[model samples]
Target: EKMPLTPNGKLDRKALPAPEGALQTGTEYAAPCTVTEAKLVQLWQEVLGLERVGIHDNFFEIGGHSLRAMTLVSRVNKEMSVSLPLRNVFFYPTVEEMAQAISELERLEYAVIPQAEARDYYPVSS
Candidate 1:
């Protein structure tokens, strides 16, 4: 359906109705399950100034922007000690996806780290 326009021939944004299936009404809210998810949710809440955040909630949909996204990435890196690409948050944009990416990165880092080994050194008499 076409959107309604004002007298000046501009689209009336305020008159626009919420998108179908986008609004969650009377639905039971689910909290973050894992530690990563929980930390992400907390960071999101602090950055977005929202009271509650769900794992599936879109970051941009909840008032997140590019600057906020950077802040989120920095916080995640500091808190989780994982280097997450900025684009990853844009691509994922959800706690669940970001957490999964972090987990994967952690796993990859673990695999790449070499195990500790003892090295024998001999001294030569001069």
Candidate 2:
């Protein structure tokens, strides 16, 4: 049975308190194996300075803001070649969801995108 209850008879997640101390490093999540999970965890650490971050932890719950969220997406693109839009993070905040998105993105970009259209173009310097 659920341990907590909200005002409206829902899960009182906000009312629930955090652990007494900082989260422990190497905490495990039921996340799948994928580059996206690794990358997302790394970004979380760089932003939060945590030795390790679990997959199920919420970014904002851990003190992330919109500015930091944007930074995260930008870093994901630059580092993982995955152009994760800002909204995507909100929708898929968990590592498992993000990994699914990353796999789908890889399939679309690599398997379906036409080579000609995907080629990087540079305008002539005048």
Candidate 3:
């Protein structure tokens, strides 16, 4: 079993065949419930070249690996504006869990500084 290679001695990814139909994994198929989850499912399907991906399906179990995980993270960062760690993919291997992690990373957690505290700042340029 060998991957198709281009004339340049590189892997011919386009020549790779896609998985047939929906991928079967250990967990039962569950459609994404939230927008984030739906986005993750779409990304996974695109990255893995599958027809359907469930929110509960494990990324690795469904034909994902480190390389595909990187591609997924790159797509998520580009499309969702959320930075995801590669290791986190292993930690949150399911679409639902990865979506939750992405949501947490995208969440804005900030504390408003007191108005009076602003007065203590000295203008360095002025």
**Candidate with best lDDT:** 3
* Candidate 3 wrongly placed segments (more than 4 Å): 1-22, 107-126
Ranking by lDDT: 3, 1, 2
Per-residue C-alpha lDDT of model 3 across residues 1-126, encoded as one tens digit per residue? 899999999999999998676555768888899999988888888999988898888889988999998998778877887768889999999988898889888633333456654565766783
lDDT of 2 at 112: 39
Q: Model 2 over residues 6-114: C-alpha lDDT tens digits?
A: 7688888876776687654344554435666887788777976766567777776666788888888777776777667799889887666776777777522322344
Clash count, candidate 2: 0
| Per-model TM-score on C-alpha atoms | 0.63, 0.58, 0.66
lDDT of each structure?
A: 0.83, 0.71, 0.84
Poorest stretch of ten by lDDT in candidate 3: 107-116
Please list all clashing residue pairs in model 2, or write none if there are none. Answer: none
Considering summed lDDT, which 10 consecutive residues are worst modelled in model 1? 107-116
